[model samples]
Target: MKAVLFANTDWYLYNFRRSLAMSLRRQGYDVLLISPPGPYGAKLRALGLRWEPLPMARRSLNPLREAALLWHLVRLLRREQPVLVHGFTIKCAVYGSLAARLAGVPARVNAVAGMGYVFTSSQMKARLLRPVVRGLLRLALGGRGARLILQNADDVALFQQAGLVDPQHIRLIRGSGVNCAQFALATRTRSADDERPRVLLACRLLWDKGLDEFVNAIRQLRLQGCSLHALLAGTPDPGNPATVPEATIRGWVAEGLVTWLGHVDDMAGLLASVDVVVLPSYREGLPRTLVEAAACGLPLITTDVPGCREVVTDDVDGLLVPKGNSEALAHAIRRVLEIPGLAQRLGEAARLKARTQFDEHIVIEHTLEVYAELCDPLAAPAESSP
Candidate 1:
């Protein structure tokens, strides 16, 4: 059997879905990947997976370009003639699903990782395009053999309410799961002589990720005489419109407000040195970093928003601050620092939650089940027409 996975960028496929692809390959499927070429394309090829480069403008709105993209997808799907086609993220999902239907693919899966910029951004452009995008999504996902995978229940509800998808076709599988074994509970602890607590905010450096809010919160904590070490991990995504510019990140690092650790490869090792993990993102499908942090037995502090709240129970496993509120974030950080034993208690609970619910094994098993259903003889039939 052959399966083709489509994504916007090679980097996304390498970083987020590599494990899933490998798992599928191990299950005796000829796994193929289709994405825009990037540095990671070679790396993916090196892993012995077939890689096809397709030009994709992730944020472009030009109708001509979009139409060309759709045509290119239809051509590729026709040539590949794979049994199953899986698309990740919004644009790929919409275009890939439509193209798969046109190519007469047997099965389709659209992973709407998050209601991205069009849904989260307050910008006028995003607002203007929301309805149009919604229409496109409805048309793309309306196929009979298609299944929609959502990372959070909030997104599932939003799509259902918008009449973009039926409840029966929606699957709520939490964020691409974290590797519990890889991020096992830390064995080390801060020595008695070490008075300062270590805090980390690891995510793509994007404006919508609340990086500014996190920096301001750290500044507030420092001004209030709190001596804590703050670490900013992950690199800026230049292709993304919301990316925090390199210059701004440099300025912050130079000012000595936070240590910049760009694109951490060993998150498990890094988590061992930190007392708290924070993601003040404005929104998410489900923040993968928070779930990984939980697996590493670290307490979390995130906004009380859809994706963040799903990973943390307010004051139970971790603290939840108001979205985009630097002051509230600062207060929460201070509370985590000042309250003796609170971090430990929260970390313990978080680790338990990770083991029981958010492990990668669970995600892989569930995803394989979906694939199995699609391959089953009794699976839903394909729509007669596109």
Candidate 2:
């Protein structure tokens, strides 16, 4: 059978869903990948996967352009006549499901990774757009042969309460699944007694990601005269409305608050070097970085919010702090560093959790089961979540 997997960015499709595509091909699937044009499209093609560029914008809200994109997808689906279409993220899910229906496609899988800006942001624009977006979700996701995959239980309940889709149609997958082998506790050790405890926050610099709180936490720790090394990875997302400014990052560096290791290509190497990893994100479908760090056997620190808590249980595998509370975040980091054997204890628990809960092989198998449930177009959509 043939399947079409679509997302807003080629980078997302390549870095995140590449393994799923490859696995499908191995399982006798004619997997066709599509995304907006990006440097990673060629990377996907080089892997012997059939990849094509689609036209769309992440931040565009123009009605005419979005409609045109929807029509284009309808035409493409009609030509390909694929058995299933799986879409990642909000915009792609909404557009892909609508197009698949228009083209008379059988099954549609919509992965709403998070509530996203439309539902989460409190800005005037986001507030105004929520009702329209919510209505679209209801129309696209509640139809025949459609299932919605969410990362955390909180999101699942939110969708159910909102009556966006039937309760039976929701699947709670922990995350994209972390590559345990690629990110593990390999060369991370303290060779010198003088080595500072290094903590990292790696994700696109976005305001709602709690980047502001991360910086403030480090500052508070410094004021307490604690010896620490803070590392910041990933670059500012220019396309995102909540993206932190370059000048602001530079300012943090100037204040000796963090060492900006921008856009790391070797994440495993970096993870193996840091003692602790943190993502004070306000909300997430699930933050990929926390799992990757957990795989690396690093102590995890995150807010006590929905997706964040799914990965770290306050006193069990790792530490959890209150969101938007820099003081509490600072306290957690300090406790991990100052308490003897605490880091090692947390690290061991975190690695074990990663291998058990968020391993890629497990996630892929569960996801493939979802596909299998809907493989037969003539068959009705499965009522139970995978």
Candidate 3:
């Protein structure tokens, strides 16, 4: 059997869906990866899977370029003739699905990782394009033997209400699952001399990620006589329009407000070194960093938004502050610091939640089941629209 996985970038494929691709390969399928070429493309090739570079502009809106992209995908799909075609992110899910149908692929899976900039942004451009994008999504997602995988129930409901997809075609699988074994509980002892707790925010440095708010919150805490080390990890995405410039990040680091650690590969080590993990993102499909941090037994502080709320029950696994409110975030951080046993309690609960619900194996098993059902009709009853 042959399967092709399409994504917006090589980095996303290597980082998020590497385990899933390996799982499929282990199951005796010849898996092919398609994405724009990058440093990570070589890593995918090194994993012993065939990697094909597909030139795609992730944020471009030019009609001629988009037409060429669709045509390229259609031709490539026709040449490969894979049994299953899986697409990740918005562009891949939309264009890929349409291309796969045109190529007569047997089964299709479109993973809507997040609503992304178009849905998240309140700009005039976003508002104008919303209806057009919705129409395209409806057309792309409407076909036989096609399934839509959403990371959160909120996204599923939004798409359903917009008439972009049928309820039965949607599957809520949570974030790309975290490997509990790899991100096991941190076992580090702090010295008596060091009393400050380490707090971290790990995500792509995007404006929409609320980095400014996090910095302001840190400043607020410091003014109130709270002493803690704040760290910002992850690289800025040049492809994204909302990317935080390197100069801005450097300025923050230079001012001693927060330590900027660019593109951390040793997340387990980083989590082990930190007392709390925070993601004040405006929105997300599901934030993987928070889930990984939870698996590593670190307490969390995040916004009370869709993806953040999904991972944390306020005051249960973590604290949830109002989105875009730096003062609220500051207060929550102080509360976590001041309270004697709150962090410990939240970390314990988070670890339990990650192990039970967001384990990598659970996600893999569920995804494989979907693939099985798609490949063999008799394996499960056909899903119907509600």
Candidate whose TM-score is highest: 2
lDDT, residue 223, candidate 2? 93
lDDT of 3 at 139: 87
Clashes of each: 0, 0, 0
Q: How do the candidates rank by TM-score, highest first?
A: 2, 3, 1
lDDT of 3 by residue, 1-386 (tens): 78899999998999889999999999988899999888999998898878989878888899999999999999998998888899998879889998999899879988887898888898888888888888888888876688899988788888888889877888888888889878884466564786689889999999899999999999988888889999999989998878999999999998889999999988888888888888999999999999998998888999998888889999999999999999999988888888999999999899999999899899888888778868877323455423
Candidate 2, residues 187-206: lDDT per residue as tens digits? Answer: 76553764897889999899
RMSD of each: 3.4, 3.4, 3.6
Range of the 10 consecutive residues with the lowest summed lDDT in candidate 1: 377-386
Candidate 3: TM-score?
0.95
Q: Can you tell me which runs of candidate 1 are displaced by over 4 Å?
A: 185-195, 378-386
TM-score of 2: 0.96
Off by over 4 Å in 3: 185-195, 378-386
Model 2: residues with Cα > 4 Å off, grouped in runs: 189-194, 377-386
lDDT of 1 by residue, 162-199 (tens): 89987788888887878887889446556477668899
User: What TM-score would every model get versus the actual structure?
Assistant: 0.94, 0.96, 0.95
